[model samples]
Target: MMRSHRLFLIAMVAILATVLFRVPAKADYYGEPAELVDRATSVYKGFLADPNLEWFRNNVGSARGILIVPQMLRGGFIIGGSGGRGLLVAQDAATNKWSSPAFYSMGSVSVGFQIGADVSEIILLIMTDRGLDAMLSTDYKIGADVAIAAGPIGGSAKAQTADILAFGRSQGAYGGVSLEGAAISPLVDWNARYYGQPVQIFDILINQKWNNRQADSLRQLLPKPRRNAQPLGR
Candidate 1:
């Protein structure tokens, strides 16, 4: 009996060791910085141009920027798991150009027996003046710096619009359960250097540099924000 107990203890220790050294899941962004920039630019620029979304985009420069982390980032288990990553770019009050984007990643772990994978998108709203101020600091915690809300889906057109106005996300899945309480935190790259780049999301919409053909394609797709909110006034 004592021998059996000793063997059980050894097995348990081995299992715990495996879990401790578990490999991190890898994600594929397709090695496409241009694609990410283009997609993010479209989202930001589209929000700006849309008559409906302009007020929010205009305010984002002053509003705390949001970080959205997809749940179940890369896949693994050993190789089966879930989580996501996000980034934010803010404009300087004086420069009027985007600062190097602040990148962040968010995720969680579980103890229950579960497996499989899913895709999720995190949308964040930077709602308060203080929240924005906190993000600009060297590093910020998710709950510490910004208020977090776990978003839900489906509603009337007006309700949907209101939901979009706040932070929200869409999740897709496979397996026994879907995880929740999706949270986020800032990603720090100490070696990276950031300078304000002259690029503006506005440039994507109206810049004449694009051939008339491309310019028209972009303009037709991007509409000016309807609310026309001014910068936060003193």
Candidate 2:
């Protein structure tokens, strides 16, 4: 009887130890990193196919980089703030190869926000080196750190000098939306999640230290790299 009791206790302890020491499951692998890129890809395709975006389609090839925000929710929710997740990728100057996409938190808080709500898809063309530099840093504001002008709509619209150009489409009660004064902050954790390791903003965007095959299709959708990424009049 004593021997049997000891054996049963040992078995229970072993089972408990096994349960306590087990390796847990990995984090949600298909979370923001994969899902956001997929959405951005769809938005990019939609923008390219839109007949109203003639200027965008024609001049995008010259951009140094592009920031695509699939859907930015703006309106009266609680108060004074609105934003969405976005991904940014830059073209290497020498190789002209597109870098891995890096996630960014984009939005602005304003006392002037209207009462109605809207969802806006925005793409910002980083037309100059300064604009690209701002994107690699910790944070940058649309109108403050870089000058931004709305991309002209028609095919005949000529390119002008600006640090960045904004292209957007909005659906809701609000008439339209402007990206001016919007702040962009790097989503470093998303990069780590997507790449399977933590990396710096510069490493992801400029140094090109990280690569994820998941983002390959999205990178391929980018406009062909142009020799000159600078603005025309600048």
Candidate 3:
């Protein structure tokens, strides 16, 4: 009897170890910085090509910064959560040039009558300096720290004045989508690996401390700011 009990415990331990090893880590979702940049470029190009997002193209010239989450997943049986990795780039007011990309992660959770899952590609346009400043912190809640509104679609949304505008292309069967309490934070491990050193979000987007040549394609896709445009402010 003693021998049988010991054998059972060992088998359980071994099975647990195998299960742990099979599961991928958070770092796996980040991929390489170059690969992420390429994906971001593709996402942006797809937005431009979509006729429903023509308002985005028209108003992009006035944006202070843009954050692109190539893919975000949300699902639940009863309780629910959503999360994804993304990159953000700021535009220089004087030169109208985009800075190096800074990586971030966004997540939200809810408990209600919800089921199934959905995947979405989200783009956030920082329309004011206040919105950009909020993102520079270590972390913040979307609607709590800063304001965000659903971007108007098609060509009819002409005069938007929100601090931040969000647009998403979602596919899958989900009850509904809500990002009101979503938290946005810097992806520290991913950023360190991408830059090959520990760096701050401001260093990448504000100070221009490092540059990756692979991001050239993404930089080119950013819309040029209107000439002599004043910086975004209240």
> What's the TM-score of every candidate structure?
0.47, 0.80, 0.83
lDDT string for model 3 (47-76, tens) is 788777777877788888999887777766
RMSD of each: 8.9, 13.5, 5.8
- lDDT by residue for model 2 over 1-234, one digit each (tens)? 999999998996775444323211111122567898998999889888887777788778778789988777665522445678889998886787888898888877767524555567888888888888888778888888677787777666777688788888876221123678888999878878889888898888888988999998998888675565555423
For each candidate in the order shown, give its overall lDDT on alpha carbons.
0.39, 0.75, 0.76
- Candidate 1 yields a Cα-based lDDT of 0.39
Ranking of all predicted structures according to lDDT, beginning with the best and ending with the worst: 3, 2, 1
Best-to-worst order by TM-score is 3, 2, 1
Candidate 3 lands at a TM-score of 0.83
TM-score between candidate 2 and the true structure: 0.80
Report RMSD for candidate 3. Answer: 5.8
Total clashes, candidate 1?
19
Score candidate 1 by TM-score against the native.
0.47
Pick by TM-score: 1 or 2, better one: 2
- Counted clashes in each candidate structure: 19, 0, 0
